[model samples]
Every structure is written in C-alpha cells, then in structure tokens.
Target: MKVYIETYGCALNKGDSYIMMTLLKESGHEIVENYSQADAIILNTCAVRLETEERMKQRIKELRKIGKKLVIAGCLVSSEPALVMNLAPESSLVGAQSVDKIVEAVESPTRRIFLEDSKELITPRVFEGKISIIPIADGCAGDCNFCITKLARKKLRSYPPRSIVNAVKEAITNGAVEIELTAQDTAAYGLDINYSLPELIKDVLEIEGNYMIRIGMMTPELAMKEIDDIIEIMKDRRVYKFLHLPVQSGDDRVLKLMNRKYTVDEYKQLIKEIRNKIPLVNITTDIIIGHPGEDEEAFNNTLGLIKELKFERIHLAMYSIRPNTKSALMPQVPDPVKKERMRIANKVYEDVAYSVHSEYIGSNSLVITTEYGKKGSIIGRTINYIPVIVKDYNKLGDWINVKITEASFFDLRGQLIQ
Candidate 1:
C-alpha cells in the first residue's frame, strides 16, 4: 500500500505522525510523496481554534474529492467524532487516545482503526528521523476551565522513562537534528507516576544526540514545582533555551475564573525564574483574548504584561467557546470585543519583538533554515527559537555564526559571518 500522511496542529502531532510513518514503512507500505499517487490519505487534524478546524474541514473535503481512502486523526476528529463523520461519511476517524494505532490503520486502512492507546504503552524518546518528535506524556493532568483538549485527551499517561531515552537515541542515530519532546503538558510529564519532568529530562539528556532538544508548553502550576531543577538540566547545550509557557490571561480574577490554578503572581514568578536562570532566553507564551468573563480591566492587564515581558514570540488567539468547556455556558464576551483584544495583543507583541531584536542589531546568531526568501537571504531560528535569516546553506543543519545586517519586526536579516 502507498500511504500519504499529512499532519497539522502542534509538534506533538508531528511526533505521532513520524512514529506512524515508521510503523507503516516497517509493515511494507510504500511512503508516497503525493496524495494523488497513494491508495489512502491520512490527514492529521488540528482543532485549536475555529479557523484551524475550518482549515482541516476544507483540506479533508479536498482530499475526499480525489477519492482516496481518507483517515482523519488528531485533536479535531478525536473531539467531535459525529461532526467529522457527518462532514465526511466515507472517512475513518480516530481520537488522540487511539493515535498509536494509525499504523495498523494504514496497513489495513480499508477498515477504521480507532487507536487511542497501546495496551503495551511502550513510547520511545528516540526514534529514527532527523526531524523527530517524541512523546513524553499523553493528554494532560490539569483542569483548566476553558480547554477542550481535556475532554478529548482524558488521561495522564506517562511513557516509561527507559523507553523514552531509547527513542531519543534512535532519532539521533537516524539524523534527527531537532529532537522535540512534546505532549499535552511536558512539564507534568511524570507526575502521575511519581516521577517528575526533571527526572525524565535527565534521562533524555544522557542520550548522545548532536541535535538540539525542544521542550513543549507547560502550565505555571507544573513549571513552579520543577523550573529550578529544569533550568539546571536546560544548561546542557543540547537543550534549547526557549520556554513556551501559556498564560491564558494576566488578570488574577480572570485566571481564577478560568480555573487555571495559578494566579498572576504565580505566573510572574515562573517567568522571572526562567529569565533569571537563562539570560536572553527566548520566552514565548500563549494569550487568549476576550474569554467569556474578560472585561476591559482584564484585557488591559494582559496587554501590560506583554509589554513588560517582551516575549520573543506570542501566540495570540481570540477566545472561541467550545461545546463542553465550563466557560461556554458563562456570560459570553462579544465577538467584536475578542477581535479588538486580539488586534491589540498582536500589536504589543510585534512592537516588543522588534525592540528585542534591536539589541541583536550587531550580534551574531546561529540558525537553521526557513522555506522562503531569495538566494541572498535564507531564514532559520536561533537556539532560543528566535527567527533569523542568514544567507548560507553550508550551515543548513549545522549551527553557524550569522552576522546581523538588519532586523525586522518578525525576523532578522543577516549574513553568514564565517
């Protein structure tokens, strides 16, 4: 069978897709580069926002039109099975819990494989791929009020530490230059099993990988408990200095309303802790505008925090109510208000991001590669996940010095100082 698997959403899904790919190839299936040349089309879906869901729907429709065996996976199909089925009746759907069985589906995808978990639960941190994503945990353990993933991914399943370490080594062996350790909450990685995130990271760092490791998003609650120790492990050159912590709201009251379990002070402490340990670390975050109860005061508090933090990057999104979340039933903020807040937050992020890059106006940065740009300018990211453009391919997978020639609000234009 020739299988074409297309993935969407976050890094976690990317990891799942790779593992599934490995399994498919092992099962003697041909991995096709084009969907039109395949017997089946597996679309790894994302449903973080309305726009993302709409995009998946459109892509699924397009694939079905080509009349291939379509399998829809990821957060979107997992969360709303009936809705997805109605949209594409011929499609087979699998939830996040059953993601591991995607390989079996591919082997015999004429039948739907509702694979959420393996009875074995043997997740490896190292797999065979240069661009690899390995799961540290599954679902999440937090109880945020407005999150739909909580319902979609209902358990706190932590992978065995030994298995994870082995996977990391395998990926490095396969030429993986960027090893991403991802899950619903990577910082809460081993809490359910009495181990901790620091312990898991310790084992992973022991693996001999020439590439860098990326730690995924963590809530303030989990970060507070392990940040100090995590900071110590992150000092290793293999660990990237970027921290992605999502502060849904900056207002203390809104935090309470959202059941985030952390107040403004707690979130600030976590931020301060990371900054104190890793100087000039790329601190990025998530901000939701116009939640059901967010007022002007709450919005203002978030804006102020963004200004103060000057996050290397901010993922700004308008609050979109989901079917099962607690906030959906509360008094809803108007759509116009959400849009206005998102606009303002994006503005603050752009302004601060530009100012932050100015300090590097004359410094050298190490980067990878971006898909776009003309011959003279190629793009890549710094160790901390800061976007940079360097005009050289000799250093494509290897890190090289990029002398800053100019700085833009979103990226830096530079030349290889070598």
Candidate 2:
C-alpha cells in the first residue's frame, strides 16, 4: 500500500508522523509524498484552538473527496473523535497514543479506530535531513483552563532515557546535526518515571556526536524546579542556548482565572535568574491575547510585561475558545476586542524582535548551516539558535564564521567570512 502522511501541530506530532511512516514502511508499505499517488492518506491533525479545529475539519472534508482510504490521526482523533467520524464516517482513526498501530489501520479492510491510551513510545530509524525531531515525552503536567491539549493527551508519559539517547545517537550517525527534543512540556518529562529532564539531557550528551540539541517548550512551574541543573547543562557547547518558557498572560487576576500555576512576579524572577546565568540565551515565549477575563487593564499589563521583558521571539495568538474547556464556559471576550488587542500586541512584538535582531549587526559569530532559505540563500543558526541567512553557501550542517550584515524581525542575514 502507498500511504501519504500529512502532519500538523507541534514538534511532537511531527515526530509521531515520522514513527508512523517508519512503522508502515517496516510493514512493507510504500510511503508516498503526494496524496494523489497514495492508496491511503493519513491526516495527522491538531486542535489546540477552535480555529485550528475548524481548519482540520475542512481539510478532512477535502481529503475525503480524494476518494482514497482516509485515516484521521493525532490529537483531533483523540480529543474529538465523534466530530471526525461525523465528517468522514468511512475514515479510520488513529489517536496520538496509537501511532505505532498505523500499519493496522492501513491494511485492515474494515474501518478501524485506535484511540486507546498506550504508554509505548516508538523511536524512528529513518530521519529526513540533517535535522531530527525526537519526542522525549508526551502529554504534560499542567491543567491550564484554556488548554484543550490536556483533554487529548491526559497524562505524562516520558520515554526511557536509554531509548531517547539511542535515538539521538542514531540520528547523529545518520548525518543529523540538529536534534530537537520535544514534548507538550519538556520540563515535565520523567516526573512520572522518577527521572528528570536534566538527567535525560546528560544521558544524550554522553553520546559521541557532533550535533546540537534544541529543547522544546516548558511550563514555568516545572522549569523553576530544575533551573539550576538546566542552566548548568546548557553551558555545554552542544546544547543550544535557547529557552522557551511560555507566560500566557501577565495579570495576576487573569493568570488565576486561567489556572496558571505561577504568578507573574515568579515568572519575571525566573527570567532574571536565567539571564543572569546565561546572558546570551535567546528566550522565546508565547502570549495569548484577549483570553477570558482579560479586560483593558489586564491587556495593558500584558503589553507592559512584553515591553519590560523584551522577548527575543514572541508567538502571539488571539484567544480562541475550544470546546469543553473551562475558559469556554466563562464569559467570552468579543472578537473585535481580541482582534484589536492582537494587533497592538503584534506591533509591539515586531518592534522588540527587530531591535533584538538588529543588535547582531556587524558582529561575527560561528553558525551551523542547517537549511536553505528563500531564493538562493542558506540558513544557519548561531549558538543561541538565532537564524543567520547566508548566500552562496549550499552546505548543510557545516560550521562556518559569518559576519552579520542585515536584520529583520523574523531573521538576520549574514555573509560568510573566511
């Protein structure tokens, strides 16, 4: 069977897709790049927000018209299986936890649904390029009122340290220079199994490889517990000096309503400690604008926090109500208000980001070429994971010195230096 797999959402979902493809191939099925060339189509969906959920629904409808054997996979299947079934009753369903059973769904003649919770975390043997995304754990410890993902992935399940280390070793051996360790909350890893994320990173670092590891998003409460160890491990040259701690809101009242575990002051102190230790660390964050209970003062507080912190990168999104979430039951913010707040927040982010990137101008830094960029340029990243686009260099995964020449809010442009 020729199977085409399309993945959406976070790095964890992409890692799951890779595992599914590997499993299918091991079962003697050919994986096709295009849906038109496949006998079956697997749509790995994401439903973190209502807008994303609607997009997934529309995508499923279109794929059904392709008339191929359609398989709905990922969080959408686990969180809203009925809606997916309603859209395409003939489609087979494979939940995020049941990724290893992809072959069964493809080969079985009868329509199938594999939504049962499983603790197994399968590692993929095949990786696509110099970058490998490895899911170290699944689910998270947080129960944020606005998060629908908690409904999909209900428990924390961290993979064995040996398995993750082996996976990282294999990826490096296969020419991968960058390994992304991802999870719903990476810092929450190993809490269920009595191990810790710092321990896992130490194990991976022991592997003999010339690669950089990019740790994924972490909840502030969990991260604060191991900040010392995390900072110590990040001092190694092999680990990227990047930390993603998402502070969804800035107002204490709003934070309480959203059920966030930490206070705004605590978040600020965490940032201060990290910066004091790793001054050059590129700290990225996420902010949801106009969530339930966010009024004019609350929105301004968020804006003020952004200005005060000056995040190197900000993933700003307007709050979208998800089905069955606590925030959805509360009084909702108006759409027009959300839009206006998002606009203001976006402008602030752009200005801050551009200023951050502009500081790199005229500086020489060592960067590892990772991927190709727009037109005839190749993109690389500094030790801090700041993207530097260089022209006339097609080599991937090679370390080179670059002199920063141009900057934008999105990325920086550099010239290869001898």
Report the number of the highest-lDDT candidate: 2
Task: Evaluate model 1: give its lDDT.
Answer: 0.79
Error of 1 at 318 (Å): 0.6
TM-score for each predicted model, relative to the true structure? 0.93, 0.99
Off by over 4 Å in 2: none
Backbone clashes in each candidate structure, one number apiece? 12, 0
Instruction: Give the alpha-carbon lDDT of every model.
Output: 0.79, 0.92
- In the range 184-239, model 2's lDDT, one tens digit per residue, is 99999999999999999999999886899999999999999999999999999999
RMSD per prediction, one decimal? 2.2, 0.8
Task: Please identify model 1 stretches exceeding 4 Å from their true place.
Answer: 107-116, 122-130, 367-377
- What's the alpha carbon RMSD for model 1? 2.2
